[model samples]
Target: MTTETVAQALLDAQVAWAINRLTGDELPELAAKAVDDVLAIAESTTMSSLADPELIKSIARTIAATVPPSTAASTLVEHSAEVVLSNPAGTYTLREVVDRDHVERITDEALGLTPLVEKVLDDLTHSPMTAAIASRFVGRIVNDVVAGNRAMAEKIPGVGSLVSFGTKAAGKAIGKTGEQFEAFFGDTAAKGAEFAMGRLNKIIIATLKDPATRDAVLEVFDLYADKPIGRLDKVLSLDDAKRIGGLGQDVVITAAASEPVLKLVDALIDGFFTVYGESPAAELLDELDITRDILVEYAVAGAPRVFAAAQESGELDRVVREQLSPFFSSSEVAAILEGR
Candidate 1:
């Protein structure tokens, strides 16, 4: 046969061999060997050589820009909500998902932000809007109480007429003087409102700082932990889920595109590179607790199903032939076959 014919025959044989090896009983062994070879290479290669921080940042930007439409987000959320609502109430309890220690830790960490809470409370209490609201609220309560007392007094048998006359007269006199009195004591009212708000802030701060607060949280968690997650359709309708999901998606999309979020993404990527850039890829995998055996096991378990599908689609033969054909058709292979 001619050199070209010989090369073509060899290429066909090589492709067949490759397909047989991938599909035969020795497939698991091949997979294990391949994994071992990859890990061996990884042991010599650093993570930065594979993926740099800039690439990761670019990927983040791409993901942020490629956010799905709100309608799609809403549909997905609605479907997820339906699936969740259809599940049994006892599918998973809070206690099963999270331990008491984790709950306690989270609660303690949140409640430890006393300074932040105090600052927020101080801002609210000292605001003009809050003072005005408090003053109006107190005035409404006082007026309600007086009206209630007058109503009750008018129900009395003998003194009803006299009480009614005195109330009307008092109301008229107060109406004439009330505006002047308010003008005179406006500053005092504002101060009083501020004082009331300050008192409320103190109470709120005290309640948060109380040791019993933690216990109360724990008790509430305990009460909820054992209870099965009942149907949530009544609490959160599908329409509500859709609306919330769309809004959440929009918010995420907007935030992810914001300068601060982009900066944060870059910072995180840089931090990761700083920690792992120089380390061998194998060491990084080890740090993640992935071992050689686990890698082999996963490869072996997943290979058959993937190859089966590829073979069914005739893709395995096509890929094997495609990979081998280039080598056989090269000038080097032709020269060797021709005894050059």
Candidate 2:
């Protein structure tokens, strides 16, 4: 699925959210409803450019005239995941018997959201809140991809739906929606959240060991010499702010910020930018090698804590406030609160 696919799903779910809030248990039924509505909308969208506003308005009028609101017209969302993953008897093939090699491929897709999540964390200039929110957003997105991939990957002996129904049906049912879902089910972080996590986690560990993904992550860490600005100085972009608001910051940040060793290198970029302004970019480039070593130390020893001399009378505020405080305090804690 592309951006459109996800966006449409999100839209349908939002509408479902409004409805499901009426009764908590209505979520699955509402999800089923949302899935049906989405399919119908998808069907209508195929013959028209519903992607365009004018076309959507035109279709809206046509629908208003031709289709009256009712049980069918009120609409429900349908998920092909259930239909695809299940055999005619409706048993899940993945749990019953998984193809080890194909399983490996699906695993890669699930863990693939990390770098993207880490990048958002590293780039947001002044927003701990946003960084956190983006982490959770990317987590769900990646999880969905895992579900889709797993649903498609598991071959139940004779079925041929490309994406398996049993897999995604199970994945979505595990409560991967929002804060309540995450709180109750533990989402992606929990090792036993779902069968998908088992496969997804194995792939993540494998990706960590893979020379390519590992090197890429390490390379990002190598760039961690940039200083970080204070909370107000955080230079959050409009897009990032919107996305962060769209998702909860704490959940996103907690999950996303857990990038094994990559978080350190990524932090260095923020820590350094906070320390030195853009004017030092050239000088920083010169010390790139040293920076890489320091970043590695950051990964190993963690962000450095400024000493009493650095923070006592606010020495950090004097010359290094933006650069090192809050990140690693004199007490050796630097996970400062960011954002306004």
Candidate 3:
């Protein structure tokens, strides 16, 4: 929280970033070479130059103890909220930050010829969970429709009404009996529920695996995939754009200082290092596709949408004129502008 500590943290982060770049080559051969080089150097390192584990632990503990979760969380949320809320040109500033020219380049690099949509489709289709869920949904709809018709018929005439009444009575009696049985059988209810769910899942999985169901799902995907981006032009048009932007901006401006936000902030800060430390960080990074190239590419590809959306909402002009223009304008220029 002191200037010195802040400076040191920045330097440490820079060193870590440097090390990551040095080791994380896209090519396997280059990565292997980098690992070998690190190993060779590490082999030659003296004990005196090596970091003390106990001392490192002690320092980590000291830093953690100093930064109380409640205070740290509150300070971070308050400061960030203040920066956005207190600024006269905050919305404009946000637009300017988003609209920079580097965004397209970033996007191009990140989105590099990956056949992203196709990959997504392939992944979804191959996922067991997706197949299982889809089958279950279809089964549930069929069952509901059939059951509804029967139930509706039971409520129609005199005999039907009597049958409906009897059905309800029977259901209540069965439920009561089941509860009593469960009470005597300890975890019988839980086991029964689990068994029922497992059987339902199996049926759903079978339905999903059916040729007709699978073909129908794929056909839907194919139809959608064939549609042009222009099909979405209306959704991203000015009226819709402003509504979306305004809603998001309103939520941020209004929600930042709330208790729920502070709780989230606290949880994130408190768990940050601990969560990642439990796993091999390198493996986690690889699994998550957190390579520098991928990250840089995603940022470039995605950054421009922020600006484009802001411009669509007429926020970009406000940012440039209100927030940026005055800095270079002298009193005479300001007066002339005022006169205009």
Writing each residue's lDDT as its tens digit, candidate 3 over 251-335 gives: 6544554567555555654465445444444444556666655645554455455555766787655554454334324455445
Question: Which residue pairs does candidate 3 place in steric collision?
Answer: 92-319, 106-300, 106-301, 107-300, 107-301, 110-297
The number of the candidate with the highest TM-score is: 1
Instruction: Give the per-residue lDDT digits (tens) of candidate 2, residues 167-272.
Output: 5566577545655656775534343233333344445556655668745644444344232312321355444544444344334334443454334544554454
Against the reference, the lDDT scores of all candidates come to: 0.84, 0.44, 0.52
lDDT (Cα) of model 3: 0.52
Q: In model 2, where do residues sit more than 4 Å from their true spots?
A: 1-101, 109-114, 130-340
Tell me the deviation in Å of residue 283 in model 1. Answer: 2.2
For candidate 1, the 10 contiguous residues with the lowest summed lDDT are: 65-74
Residue 200 shift from truth in candidate 3, angstroms? 1.7
Candidate 1 lDDT over residue span 57-121, tens digit each: 99987776665444665577667767766664546778888899999999999899977998998
What TM-score quantifies how close candidate 1 is to the native fold? 0.79
Ranking by TM-score: 1, 3, 2
